[model samples]
Target: AKIKRVKGPYGKVHRGFLKGLTLVWSEIREVIREWQIHGQSVWVTGHSLGGALATLAVAAFGEEAKPIHGLYTFGQPRVGGKTFARNFDLEYQARTFRFVNNNDVVTRVPPRNLGYRHVGTVLMFDHAGILQTDLHFWNHFLDRVVGRIEDLGKPGTDGIKDHNMA
Candidate 1:
């Protein structure tokens, strides 16, 4: 996907993700305002591609009259570059939880080398389905090794299998 600089505080993000958000933002904003009017906090969540859009939605809502209560995403890909990640983290790090299931491949792209990066705190589930917070790289590496070995007989790669929401 191509990167484009949005004309707001989010810095540069994935063009496709930005376009997806733009297509539905007005409706989403209206719903959020309706909820806020009733004194309800607005929490956003999505999985995979939707996750990426959810991230942009929260950032877009940051300057609105009502703030987003929280954001949660699953198997989300990198949405932007360093500036966007840093800015988003500064604002919503405590309010965002990004879940990665085992070796879910979606979370690792569009490749840091391409200047894309993920925002929010990561809460990962290892191969044994045990939840881990802020796991060290060595520990994460060993877990992936174990998962791949266990998945040797499986039809698909562990990364792809792990991406399943189920």
Candidate 2:
């Protein structure tokens, strides 16, 4: 089937806004129907385009349907417009997680004007990027108390440099 683009905060569909999400939802259903022949399960996650499709696929699965195993995405831009940005996942019950790096700018594609913020704690990979603020001091103090100085994603072998990309 043919596809048209959605309108994003920028020119249009820069991040696959929900302008035409219903079509994608239908396509996902087709995959599920076809996959049922094997009696297998489906898990969804993505960094960019895959993330957009995952979001729409799970949402289209309906409220009572079994929630997908997990929803993980990195450097994923805003999926919908100004309104969906606020409450799109209100009723959805999936384990949603986003891994964002300080310098990885793909997460803010189109750079719209708004106040949406990542809910998870920032796993600071580079301390140099942070300002010398009171909050930083507090976090360091807490780290000392807990005896865990490095974030889970900050280890030298954590591949932050490789995977912290767009």
Candidate 3:
């Protein structure tokens, strides 16, 4: 993957993702073109790191992303700064759906202090299994592969346990 910094309104972005998208874009475009010819709609979804890639991909696609049936991402880290977020929101017009487990800690990263801001409508999953905006910064490290399941699976688990996307 090529790693060149692409300039966004607020800062630079991961070039590897952009390069990957460029490499695959022709195929994706062909598929979408065929689907559109058949009156079908396009959709995109991703989780964690993939979510960031999906967001970047959609943004890079620009107008091509507008016709997508939906865009959903889970446990995504902040992708860019305020300017990038603003531009993405304007271009996609709420088409992106950022799903955050309110307890998940990963969502808070690249920190706002670093100028990273999220784009699209944030659909937060509160501790109650209901959607809400109540988020805690300590919930991002619930990865099963990292042995967090033991603590997370306990009865009445709160705090970090709630961060598990699994």
Error of 1 at 126 (Å): 0.1
TM-score of each: 0.93, 0.50, 0.69
Model 2 / residue 124 / CA error / Å: 6.5
After superposition, candidate 2 runs with Cα above 4 Å error: 1-16, 19-25, 34-40, 63-66, 112-166
Judging by lDDT, tell me the better candidate of 1 and 3.
Answer: 1
Kindly list the per-residue Cα lDDT of model 1 for residues 1-166, writing each as its tens digit: 5455455446888887888888998998898889988999889999999999999999888756368889999999999888889888988999999999988999998888888888999998998999999689999999989989999987988999999955
lDDT of 3 by residue, 28-118 (tens): 7787778878998778888877887788767766744436666799988777767778887886746788887645667777677766678
Model 1 ranges with Cα > 4 A deviation: 1-9
Highest lDDT among the candidates is held by which one? 1
List, residue by residue over 70-156, the lDDT tens digit for candidate 2: 566665655554444433345443366655544344555544544333321223333334422234756644533332334344555
- For lDDT, candidate 2 versus 3, the one ahead is 3
| lDDT (C-alpha) at residue 157 in model 3 | 49
Q: How far is candidate 2 from the true structure (C-alpha RMSD, Å)?
A: 9.2
How much lDDT does each candidate structure score? 0.88, 0.48, 0.66
Q: Per-prediction RMSD in angstroms? A: 1.6, 9.2, 6.1
Position 44, candidate 3: lDDT: 82
Which pairs of residues clash in candidate 2, taking residues 3 or more apart in a chain or in different chains? none
Clashing pairs in 1: none
